[model samples]
Structure formats: structure tokens, C-alpha cells
Target: MLYRTLGGTGIEVSAYCLGTMMFGSVGNPDHAESVRVIHAALDAGINFVDTADMYSAGESETIVGKALKGRRDDVVLATKVHFPMGEGPNRGGNSRRWIVKEVEESLRRLGTDWIDLYQVHRPDHTTDIEETLSALTDLVRAGKVRAFGCSTFPAEEIVESHVVAERRGLGRFRTEQPPYSILARGIERAVLPTCRRYGMGVLTWSPLASGFLTGKYRKGGAIDLTSGR
Candidate 1:
């Protein structure tokens, strides 16, 4: 498979990163089967793996961890934060406190010393961008994470983050993982352009619209997702 250097970071990731949103209890509950998919993806030359801590309340990362037990070094692993990990008021978000703590949780679950790319899963209206950058910068400096990025941020937020990171001596967001699908083309006019302006890499999520395009979600039927909250 083809590989490309992620933005300015020297880490080379596969052209096709295996997304693990559906590998856990929220989507698929079969841990053994999920492990098979992950191994097969690695065997097929997909060296990049993207997941999130909130996925199935962290079960997805566990499966990924088990799958990469022996071959972890061959993958460019990425995961996200910002969603609530528990009922605690401060259990999640883009705040420095949460980022600093949640990253360790992510590291522990993935069974890796460093993450290839750690991303802010979504914009946190309550938290300052500088706070997030400051925390992530600490991770990079400590070698706990190679780089950090953001996902689903507005075009303006992306620009502001770059400015703030530069001004405050924090690590800049080297990538953007926005949700881009045929049903969602709004990013093309703005988000993509903003990322390009800052030389940030683009790793889109839900290019298939969470299986909406696969005829899996039947018209007029109830939604597939049932919130635990």
C-alpha cells in the first residue's frame, strides 16, 4: 500500500487507515471477530489505525490493543478525546486537565508508550483552544505522543488554533479529521481550504456516513443507535 508523510511530521501513514468505530459493543460485540478484522487490515498493508476512547466506553481500544499485541510498531495509531469517558464533570473535554489525564488512559488502553496522532474529537465550546494546545504540547515534549490534531472543527476554529499555538509556544495541530461524506460537502468550501492554508493533513471520518450510504439504515425505520445515557 502507498504511504504518505503525515503533514510535517516524519511519520509515514498508510493511504488507507483502518477506522475502528464499529469494532466494539456499540456496533459489533464480538471481540475475537473484531481482532480478526484488525489483523486482516494490518496484513493487507493498512498501517494506520484510528479509534476513540469513547467508542463503546473504551472497549474498541481494548480490542485494538489486543490485536496489535505483537505488531504494534508497524501501525500509525491515532485516537481521539473530548467525549465524556464517565459521569464525572471533568472526565472529558478539550481542557488541559482532561487532555493531560485522558491521554494516559488512551495510552494505557492501547498498550503503547506513544500515540502516532492524538486528536481532539470535537470542538469544546466550554474549553479554550490554548488550554488544549498547551496540554497536548506537554505530551509531545514528554514523548508520550508524537503529534496532536483536531476533528470536526470549524474553519475559523482551525485558523484560530494555529494562531494560538504559535503565539503561546504550543504544539500546532498538524492534522484535521473532519467527517466528510457525499452527504456532507460543506467542508470542501471552507474546512479543507483552511487546513491547506496551514499545511495540515486531512484524515476524514465517516466518508460512508456511518453506513447510511450502504443501505443499512432503512428509510423510515428506527435509528440503529440507542443511547445509553
Candidate 2:
């Protein structure tokens, strides 16, 4: 696999990242098989792995932890927060309280001391971006996370985050995870350009349009709803 530099961070990652969202009970329930697939991807020169805490309620992270037991340092491990992990009032979102607590939980599940790339899973309109950045800045300073980023944010939100980070002198997100595929090119108009302007790496998800490009889903026929695709 080809490697590319993520924005200006100097960290090299595989152009072909192995996503682990379907590794747990959400998609594949076989633990051994999941580990084998992860190892296979690693062997095939995939150095980037992305996951989230909400994936199968954190089971995906646990499975990834088990798979990366001895070769953890060889991969660029990334994961996200800001999703509902429980039924509590303060269980999720970009609030400092939830971020702080969820990071620990994610670390425990991933069995890692520091995440290579920690990301906010989505935009949290309720919490100020400053609050999220401040908490993330503390994490960077404390060595809990190497770098951080955001996902599924609008162009304006991305710009606002950059401006706030500059004014506040906090650690800024180095990457953006957007949904980009053959069918979804809306980000190209503004979000991609903004990310380029701010020197943020772009890690897109559902590049196959949730399996729409696989020829399995027709215009008026059977569609694969598995994995929420």
C-alpha cells in the first residue's frame, strides 16, 4: 500500500486504511475471524486503522486491542468519541466531561496508553468547540493522545474550529473524516477546500457509498441494509 503524510503532521499512514467498525457484534461476531482479518490487513501493508467507541458499544475497540497485541506500534491507530455510549444524560457528546471520561474508556478498550489519532466522531452543536478543543489540548499536553481531529463537520464548523484554536492557543485538530464516495461528493465543493486551506488531513469513510458501488443495490431492487449501509 502507498503511504501519505497526514496534513502537515509528518505522520505517515497507509493510503488504504482498514476500518474496524464492523469487527464486533455489529457485523461480524466471530472474534477469531475478526483478529485474523485485522492481521491480514496489517500484513498487507495497511498501517492505518480507524474505529469508534460506539461501534458495537465499544466491542470493536476491544477486538482491535486483541488483534494489535504485539504490533501496536507499527500501525497508526485512530478512534472516535462523541457518540452515545450509554443511557445516561452525560454519556456522550463533545462536552469536556464526556470527552475526558470517554477517552479513558476508549483507552481501556483499545488497551493503549495513547491514541495515534483521537477524533470527535461528529459535530456537537450543544457544546462549544472551544470546550472540546480545550479538553483535547489538555490530553495532548498530558500525553494521552498524540493528535486529534473531527468527523462529519460542516465547512463553517471546520473553519470556526481552526479560528478558535488559533485564538485560544490550543491544540487543533489535524484531520477531518468526512463521508466521501462516488455518490457523495458534496464535501468537494467546500469542506475539502477548507481542509486544504487549514492543512487538515482528509480521511473519508463509506467510500463505496455504503455498498452502493458494489453492484449489490439496484435503483429499485434489493439493497443491503447490513452494517447500516
Candidate 3:
């Protein structure tokens, strides 16, 4: 796998980051099998791993944590927050209260003292971007997270967040994770160029278009739900 520096941060990561969204009950449901797959990817030279606290309600992080027991230093670990973790309304969003607690939980589950990249899973329309940046800045200063970023944000929101970070003197998000594939080209219109202009590293997801590129989903044949029916 080719490695590239994420934006100007100087941290090199594999071009194909091993995504662990499928490691937990949401996908594999088997802890041992998930660990084996993670190890296999690591053995194949995949030095980046991306996961989220909300994946399988946090089971994915637990699985990835165990997988990285002796090898956390070798891989660039990235994870996201700002997703609903429970029934309470406060359990979600990018507010300072949630961001502080969520990141700690994420670190606990990953069994690491610091995350290479800590990201807001998505933009919260309700919370002020300044609030989110402020909380993230604290995390970076405290060494809980090396860098901060976001995922699935609209171009305008991305720009706005940068502006807010600058105005408030907070550490800015250095990367953007947008869903990209041959079929979904919407981000190409603005998000990609915007991130490029801001010097933000862009890590795309669903490169296979949620299994559309695998040629498994036919018009009339039997369908497999496990592979995205």
C-alpha cells in the first residue's frame, strides 16, 4: 500500500485504510474473526485503521482495541464521535459535554492513551462549530488526540468550521472523510476541491459503493443480505 502524508501533519498513512465498521455485531458479530481480519490487514501492510464509537454501538472499537494490543504504535489509528450512543438526546451531537465524554470513551475502548486522528463523525447542525472545535482543541493540548478531523461534512460546513476554528484560535481539523466511489460523485463537485484548497487530507469511504462494484447484486438472482442486500 502506498503511504501518503495526511495534509501537512507529517503523519504517513496507508492509501487503503482498514475500516473496522464491520468488525462488530453490525457486520461480523464474531470478535475472534474480526481480530483475525484486522491482523491480516496489518500483515498485508495496511497501517491505517478507521472506526467509530457508534459502530455496532461501540463493539467495533472494543474489537479493534484488542487487535491493537501489541501493535498500536505501528498503525495510524483513527476514530470518530458525534453519533447517537443511546436513547438520551444528549448522547449525540457535537456539544462540548458530549465531545469530552465521547472521546474518553473512545480512547478507553481502543485501549490507547492517544488517538492518531480523532474525528467528529458528522456535522451537528444544532451545535455550534466553535463549540466542537474548542473541545477538540483541549483534547489535542492534553495529548488525548494527536490531531482532529471530521467525516461526511458538506463543503460549506467544512469551510464554516475552519473559519470558526480560526476565529476562536482552536486547533483545526486536518482531514475530511467523505464517502466517495465511481457512482457517488457528489463530493467531487465541491467537497474534494474545498478540502484540497484548505490542505485537508481527504480519506474516502465506500470505495466499492456499498458492494455495488462487487457484481454480486443482480436483477433476479438470490440476494445476500450480509453483503449489502
C-alpha lDDT of all candidate models, in order: 0.91, 0.93, 0.92
- After superposition, candidate 2 runs with Cα above 4 Å error: 218-221, 224-229
Candidate 1 deviant stretches above 4 angstroms: 217-229
Listed in order, each prediction's TM-score against the native is: 0.94, 0.97, 0.96
Q: Per-residue lDDT tens digits of candidate 3, residues 55-132? A: 999999999999999999999999999889999979989999999999989999999999999999988989889889
Error of 1 at 16 (Å): 0.9
Q: lDDT rank, highest first?
A: 2, 3, 1
Top lDDT hit: 2
Query: Ten residues in a row with the worst lDDT in model 2?
Result: 220-229
Model 1 poorest 10 in a row by lDDT: 220-229
Return the TM-score for candidate 2, rounded to 2 decimals.
0.97
